[model samples]
Target: MSRSRIVIVGAGFAGYRAARTLSRRFRGAAEIVLINPNDYFLYLPLLPEVSAGVLEPRRVSVSLAGTLRGVRLVLGEVDGVDLAARKLSYVDPEGASGELRYDRLVLTVGSVNKLLPIPGVAEHAHGFRGMPEALYLRDHITRQIAMAAGGEDPAESDARCTFVVVGAGYTGTEVAAHGKLFTDSLARQHRRAGSGLRGDRLPRWMLLDIAPRVLPELDERLSRTAHRVLTKRGVEVRTGTSVKEATNEGVLLDDGEFVPTHSLIWCVGVRPDPLVEETGLPSDKGRLCVDEYLQVPGHPEVYACGDAAAVPDLTHPGKYTPMTGQHAVRQGKTVAQNVAASYGYGERRPYKHNDLGFTVDLGGLQAAANPFGVPLSGPLANAVMRAYHLAALPGNRVRVASDWLLDAVLPRQAVQLGLVRAWSVPLESSSPETAHAPAWSGHGYGPDGNAAEKPSQG
Candidate 1:
């Protein structure tokens, strides 16, 4: 008899952990297939470090095939799911399409950037969701500083130097905090070369959020610490504020204020991938609805977790778990165990995890973190943040550590790679294949357009 086949979608924090756990439990008893556009699992929390030039982009990506033994890795973006038929359709890297049948399907398809109806935001603002975006931001920041130094008009130079970041959540806060330091360092180098760039009056950075404080969802202590540090570093932190509109020149604030900036980094929160909408499954607040066991209701063979699934928060009674890597990692383990139990291996258990706490890296020797209920700040918090990331990442710890060591001891090497374009990394797409091309080519195309291929093997 053929081995029981289990397919997991979206090889992110949740799906990667699920595949790893199932591979260890089933060994060769079951065939585990992970379907995703990329062959690696990205450690998303450290993405800001990539954008800030503290860590290389590849440092945050762990190779799925290289790390997960006995698990089959399929490179594709799942576009369709036939629930009654128990099959999934996907498009591969080389632009081919195919399908796969599974005994159990895990819909871990993660979230994408959540965009508002703000004018020109979808067209202008680049998001910081994936590796490519990080790379693009790194290059863009370096280029902006370079261009500011060379430009003749002082007003144009100031505009090029100014960076406007929308959203002051963890991602935005981290980006703005680290981004200021990076641009300052770049300005220093330009001034040394007699490039007419002044060291004292360097580029300006503004962080905007609709909440009352930076990292509003985090502990109050962390928010206060982060806000203080950013203020000292000269970051303009505007609370209870948001972008009303975005244009080629800059962003318009809700308070009827317009800021001129060549760089507008959008770190707004994420929503479940649009693919979830195509599933025709029951949803709660734009997320696929799943039971405490991480199984889709009315379909025991179907499981969902991560940012895509609205898993019940038993601890909160009526609330759903927040979209964080911490929760997704734990939920992935639970889903794997439940799937094994369905195969008669063991009894299944519901997923329940208490908040371990949150960490916000403020770049350099500053950070705001609450680990296991302990409020930490300054260098100590930065140490804790670095240690947590090293422990959480699945692979390449040595390389990441080495990069940190170099960044601490040596100056940052600032140069634009210019590989990723603003058009490539939009404010919405997460998966690489779709992010590689324009949004219209991947989703909006009809049958007349060439369809992307499916690269799944069994």
Candidate 2:
């Protein structure tokens, strides 16, 4: 008999872990294939550090091939799925087409950026989801501060120095917190170099959210701690407010107030990948609906997990698991076990994970955390946060730790590589978590026009 083939889609935390577990358990027993747009897995939790110039991009990009010993890495994005025929079509980096047939399929396509219909936001704002956006922001922030020093108009200089970040989740909070430190350091450097800009004039950063408080979804204790740290770091936290419109000049808040800023970062939440719509299957919200076994109902051969799947929280009875890495990582392992059981290799089990508390890194030696429901703050929280991240990362421990140590002692190395440009990192990218060129050519990306191929890989 031919060897059973298992195809796993995506390479985020869940998909990566699934591939690794299946490769080890099946060994030569099955043909394991992992398909994704990039060759490496992005450690998304540290992305804010990338944007702040505190960590190099490569440090967070874990190579899928290096870690998955028995799996074949196929680089491309799956755009279409034929459920009845058990086949899928994808477009490669060179925009070429290909197909794959599988006996068992794992769908962990992950989530994309969430957008609201605010005016001018699609054109003026940029999101912080993937590697390219972080790189672009790092360079863009540095350039804005440096060039503002040489400009003749003080208003324009202040506008250039000002930054507005939307959403107050962990991503937005960390970006604003670390972002202030980064721009402040640059301002000092300019003054030391006699660039006319005052070192003492700190750049302005405004963090806006429609919620009642920062980290509104987290524990109240965490919310208070994060709010305190951001305030101490000079971040203007605007709660119970939202952007009404975005323009080249600045943003208009719903309160009829206007603020001038050259930078607008959209860190709102995410939805399932667009590919979910093409599947022709029932979905919860936008996510592919799957049972506790991670299998799509009525399609035993199809399994889904991670941010793309709406898996029921058996522990909570009626609730679905939130889009988070906490559940996704454990769900991946369960996917492997269930798939094996279907082949008479092991016993299948339902996905059940207890709620662990959350953690928010506020940059520097400040953080808010509720581990096992025990809330902690200040340096103790920071230490626990760092240790948690180090333990969670699959690889690159030394490089990431070394970067952190260097950042503690030396100033951040801020230099624009000019690899990523403005035209590449648009705010309205169809998939917040993925990148593509404008028109996508044969690749099938959409109308907003982010056509640079360099970003699509990440």
Give the per-residue lDDT of model 2 (tens digit) for 1-458.
36999999999989999999998888878999999989999999899889888889999999998888999999888989999999999988788999999999999999877889998887788888788888888988988888888887888889899999999988999899899989988888888778867547899999999999998878889999989989988999999999999888899999999999889989987878878878989997889989989999999999999999999999888889989998899999999999989998789999999877777878888888999999999999989998999999998989999999999999888676766666567776654444545544664444655443423211
lDDT of 1: 0.87
Instruction: List model 1 lDDT by residue over 1-458, tens digit each.
Output: 36989999999889999999999999999999999989889998888888888898789889998999999988898889999999999989899998999999999988888888888887778887888888888988998889889888888788789999889998999999999999999999998888866546978999999898888788889999999999999999999999888777777899999888878888878888888888888998789999999999999999999999999999999999999999999999999999999998889999999998888989998988888999999999989998999999889999999999999999989988777766667675656324565445554433433224421000
TM-score of each: 0.94, 0.95
**Candidate 2, which ten residues in sequence have the lowest lDDT sum?**
449-458
Stretches of candidate 1 off by over 4 Å are 430-434, 438-458
Q: On a 0 to 100 scale, what is the lDDT of residue 36 in model 1?
A: 91
Q: What number of backbone clashes does candidate 2 have, counting pairs of residues 3 or more apart or in separate chains?
A: 5
lDDT, model 1, position 349: 97
lDDT of 2: 0.87
